[model samples]
Target: MPDDVSTAGRPHIDIASVQRLAELADYVVPFAIRAICTLGVADHLVDGPLPIPDLAKRSNAEPQALLRVLRALAGKGIFTETEPGVFGLTPLAQPLRSDHPVSLREAYPLLVGDLQAWARFDYTLRTGRSSFEYVHGMGYWEYMVEHPEESKRFDGSQAAGTRVEVRTVLSAYDSWAGLNSVVDVGGGNGMFLIGLLSRLRHMRGTLFDQPHVVANAHGLLREAGLTDRCTVVGGSFFDDDVPSGADAYLLKRVLWSWADDRAHLLLSRVREAMREDSRLLIHEPVSFPGDSDEVGKAYDLILLTMGGGCARTEEELHALLGGAGFRISRVIPTPMFPLVEAVPAT
Candidate 1:
């Protein structure tokens, strides 16, 4: 078939190319969803459908504007328009609910928070510096630290995300069930340890992160009935000590936020916390040739824009781990990133 073929005496057309272009340029749907999530629109409609005026008032949004956004999202099957001016929840919109069993309400906004950074992606492409810093006048971590409320929300979103990723990590690694104890370095709010210790009844764990981050871990661990089995410690992974002598030390979804030097320093910190027999388990997406992981690719750019980081390949990981004085014992592949296990070199 020709790239463009005439039909009914009209000019040649390429529907596939047109579709690809439209897909690339489409941003309205995502932005609309982000707006709704940010405004707590879905949470307000939990009781039942609400007229646009009531919904808007509840969400502190303009009635007409909220109606228009809902109408647009309804067409995309996000929310439902039972009748004109009345909006209700749909199956697709359930996760947007803050009270839902699985909530992504916080993640969406945090993902798209720096729209200005994304708009200036060319700056990252040209200079290899963080567009987030360029746009916000500070790096992502500094901004988070300066803004306590936003930092808390970011921690919420990360803990929520860890809930979903925990399944992947657990199912992909059978050795977790066998471990007697594990330490979750940089573990936010102890979600991962909660899930792990809940299943492996005999296992004890420790959750380590910054002071502000681990402050919530105590209550959460208590609520999960894991307080007795898990210890919470507060410190930076770069300059502070991690809990040592656990059967395994976990670095999950954490290192990708930093460039190689910081990442190496973090790994070395964890290295100092490990015994010779202790396993260092790193859970993150690793790049490789012929890889078509769009999520990983998108994250590579997200990391670049936010923090001047990029997804590393297995070889890059090997070098980093080696520099941190560990040897890769095995690399276990998973549906997402492979779990790279290492042990102390000497």
Candidate 2:
């Protein structure tokens, strides 16, 4: 009889059980971290290290419960206990601070907090429909349009992720050098446009998005000192036309929000407005045909849950663009996102 197997006087353990336990344990960590971020623990610790009781008082949370949460996070190296009963920030936790330019505080809550539509994610897995649609009885975009506060949180979360990638795209693509004007199609909150226009002083930009989304962009453009170089336009991409006479048009993290049919519609609209020589840049995660990378796979699920879309392989993108009258001209790699430059085939 094997020592690992159960006899009348012994017990058995399986490796599968260990794997399952680790997976379940991993699930609890995100929710716990979300609670701390939502309670502003990182923000409270911004000035200096504090004891658990002080943190509890400032956050209006019970000392004992908050201590347990912090202790768990410390185990994960998010924070450290430098002295008995006192906590301090760790390098990993710095990004959680609200004042950080690329803070993950908003992203944390958006991904795990009370407003997370994925709490009912089982509904999505079972029905093969979007969790946002299943839980809210509407699509993510429709839900955002209906709830202004939630929309703001969603936008802030997106902006945080975009800030990291915007600079990478700007530096990687050489197409911006001689362009006189650029139009950002479906540009949310205008972060990409702001980054691009800020870099190229002589270039002008037009930001096009839904009416409510574009409303938020106006203030951002002004804050970026780009008011003189940018224009904000509001309309649906499905029904309305894109701005004409731009030398470059960009769709950053945009097309993956819809299925192929709708994506084709959007590309068609951009093609109609583009001059024969205009450049079209599509920035997104280029999923390889067989490789399984974490962000690419997780984003695949996020797309399915938030909307009925999927990330595409390079070949898939070529087909998608070709079907809509555009052809791939070059593939530019950045540290974060890939830039696919296309042009009108005819």
Candidate 3:
């Protein structure tokens, strides 16, 4: 028998709806954590468990306000409340510690600080324009050229992230065994060249980037003691030809920085310079369709916002390489990025 109670007597709650709301609410936590990490709150706690007042003092944040932020983070297992007002770092917060091997402090702030520009992301969705160009008055590269300090932060933060990935890439590739020279297209500060040359004693390398970028490469080369073996070339990839006659040409995190047209142009330039047997190695986070990975999705938005760049699928890469007069030889996966090796199709 049906109950006499009206339908309105039943509870109006929906579990799925409640869960979705909870997830939406949780999104702000990561930004808060980014803010705290950027403020070096975790570094201050490194010495010992500290009260909220002292922690706020060290981080230069207001005590009451900072406590509220930390309290929210504490609920997420990032930090723990030792007692009434004392807080201590947790295992999950270890990466935020400035001195950690793979510390994300710099990377976190760089991303979060750029959040303001993203408020205009709807402009990209509506007009197919870059959020950066919509919010700022210029493209990312132009802005970087004008703002030296911000450029330094952007370069340093990117290089720091690249350091972890580069080691994995270096291990995945067989040493440039028979190659005399390798050209790293768009190599900023020669981080990749340093890693490769460190392993291959017989190899000489060229680090090609903008004038200012290359200006700093010599210092890195000297620090790595590869100044005698490496050359730093300052020129635009679009206007100038990459140094020709190298056995292997490398583009790490470069192609994804442009749209299809620009990528095609860059690859075509590389093809024109390549000998019949020259190899091209492209290292990037290759996206696969229908597979929505977190890093790929986040990077997709980043590329959209930063410079109208994007993460490409394997099929897209194949078509781009094919159009550029190159044949896909192999796609090797590393711990970080996938290396797509190609040779002149002719």
Return the top candidate by lDDT: 1
lDDT of each: 0.84, 0.83, 0.82
lDDT of 2: 0.83
lDDT of 3 by residue, 138-255 (tens): 8887877787777777766776677666677767877457788899999887887887888789999988888877887878888899989998899888989888888999998899
Task: Give, for candidate 2, the lowest lDDT window spanning 10 residues.
Answer: 108-117
Q: For residues 1-346, could you state the per-residue lDDT of candidate 2 as single tens digits?
A: 8867787756577888888789666767788887777787889888878998888999889999988888888888988888877888999898888898668887765432224667777887888887777677777767767777877776667777887777788789876788999999999778888977887898999999999878888788878889989999999889998999899999988888778999999999999999999989998877876664535567777787887578898999999999999999999877766789999997
Residue pairs of candidate 3 with colliding backbone atoms: none
TM-score of each: 0.83, 0.84, 0.82
Error of 2 at 181 (Å): 2.4
Which runs of model 1 end up more than 4 angstroms from their true locations? 1-13, 47-54, 110-113, 236-241, 275-277, 323-337, 343-346
Query: What TM-score number comes out for model 1?
Result: 0.83
| Candidate 1 vs candidate 3, lDDT winner | 1
Per-residue lDDT of 232 in model 2:
92
Residues 98-157, candidate 1: write the lDDT tens digits.
987658887776444468789998999999988899989998878877878777777776
Itemize residue pairs with steric clashes in candidate 1: none
